[model samples]
Target: MAESRSETLRVAWHGGDRFEIQIRGHSVRVDEPKDFGGSDTGPTATELFVGSLAACVADCAERYLHRCQLPAGVTVTARYDLGLQPARLSKVALDVEAPGLPEGLRESFTAVIRHCPVHNTLFRAPEVTFHVLTSGHEAVCHHP
Candidate 1:
């Protein structure tokens, strides 16, 4: 049987282009740069998006090394380019480094990290739907 899971996050505006996000009991803040008219308090959401991918890849690499009974030291540097026409990310590149990795294991390690959940998600886009709720005495939360 396939395992199923559900995750939810809440984001609330914290004044002037800043937002506070709650994720599984941890809180993170995100804001735009001063040039973008924000207070420059924290990383932008776009940066977090790319960072999540990098972290996921690194985590996969580390786990693979641990399973092999080797030191799980992994580093991932990520770069992305934005497409102005669509105002979206057009290119993303990741450079993963695992020092002292055996040459024989390099190919397998690369293959393992490439299958990270974040990488898989980007390769297959998920459907998104939005529902708007307005304040009213009779309003109630609905799940679908």
Candidate 2:
């Protein structure tokens, strides 16, 4: 049997081009840079996207190394480029730095990153749809 879980996040406009994001019990801010008429208080959507990918890969790499009995620190940095014409992601470049990685574990670490959730997700893109509520009934929230 396979098991799965759901993830949900909420965001509300915070005046100007800033938004308040709620994930679990934490609050984060998302906004555009000052040159784009924003307060530049936090990372923009593009930054979050690339940042998530790096974080995901780093986490998986670290876990895989430790499981091999060679625990080491991992750092991942991703650079993104904007595609023209339609304005989409053109390319993503990632640098994985593991200063303490064992000599024989390079191949295994590379393989582990290949299966990183975020990296795999990019390999097989998921469906993304937009919905707008022109008119709808008031919804109630219930929490425990």
Candidate 3:
């Protein structure tokens, strides 16, 4: 780890539609439900997005609380409303509960959530560029 560094994450298939994700020093697994051709071994893609937002906010709040010398008790529950017409994510609501926090710092906590990178990014349309690579079958893999 170093100051002002850029990092890249990697994700590869483990087995049976379950993916192995390498991030920082952690290995995460993402899988589909049994009905969707998976054994329900891990969280699905939709769950991952909800979980990421919750976890990111919690991480930000935790740092702020630590700086304020507050006791550690932070919880974030994320709920999503799916739209059927386009099979899209309609809305995501987060219920943050911090029992050990002081009332005086409540405003700052709201600001922290507003300023959280993940939170802000979710509201904006991302510029996603797709790149396709072609090979001559020289390097073939069973993995997707």
Candidate 4:
């Protein structure tokens, strides 16, 4: 095994149900639709979460095709089911289409794409901790 690496994403509220995310010098926004009391400015956080998985699968498939000198035409569609009680995602389904790929490599292709990081993470959950800060200090400084 190798040493683990960490990355950070910064998110700030941008009024209402909207938030701005900053990652590696790029900015993305997340919000709810108008029906959910949001301005419909961007995709909701749940959408982004599933999008990451789909994108990872697509990228992995494309890389495998390229490595084998095959024509690249990969598409991944993802659908998720939300669960109640705790308001969490319960299941995710992915449909991957790799047109023009040879028939013999179908199983291999599936195996490779299944190893995508986002998909593997779902199998082994990560630990999370929350911290609250006030003013410029650690949960103590007060603001006026």
TM-score per candidate:
0.90, 0.86, 0.80, 0.89
Cα error, residue 125 of model 2, in Å, equals 1.6
Candidate 2 local lDDT, 50-82, one digit each (tens): 898899899998888788767588888888898
Candidate 4's displacement at residue 106, Å, is: 1.2
Top of the candidates by TM-score: 1
RMSD to native for every prediction? 4.9, 6.7, 4.6, 4.1
Clashing pairs in 2: none
Candidates sorted by lDDT, descending order? 4, 1, 2, 3
Clash list (residue pairs), candidate 1: none
Pitting candidate 1 against candidate 3, the one with the higher lDDT is 1
What's model 2's TM-score? 0.86
Superposed by TM-score, candidate 2 places the C-alpha of residue 41 at a distance from the truth, in angstroms, of 0.7
Lowest summed-lDDT stretch of 10 residues in model 3? 132-141
Question: Judged by lDDT against the true structure, how good is candidate 4?
Answer: 0.93
Q: Write the per-residue lDDT of candidate 3 for residues 28-86, one digit (tens) a residue.
A: 88999999899788898788988988998998888888988888878999999878877
lDDT of 2 at 3: 79
| CA lDDT, every model vs. true structure | 0.92, 0.87, 0.84, 0.93
**Can you tell me which runs of candidate 3 are displaced by over 4 Å?**
1-5, 137-144
Considering lDDT, which of the candidate structures 1 and 4 is the better prediction for this target?
Answer: 4
Error of 2 at 51 (Å): 0.3
Q: In candidate 1, which residue ranges exceed 4 Å CA deviation?
A: 136-144
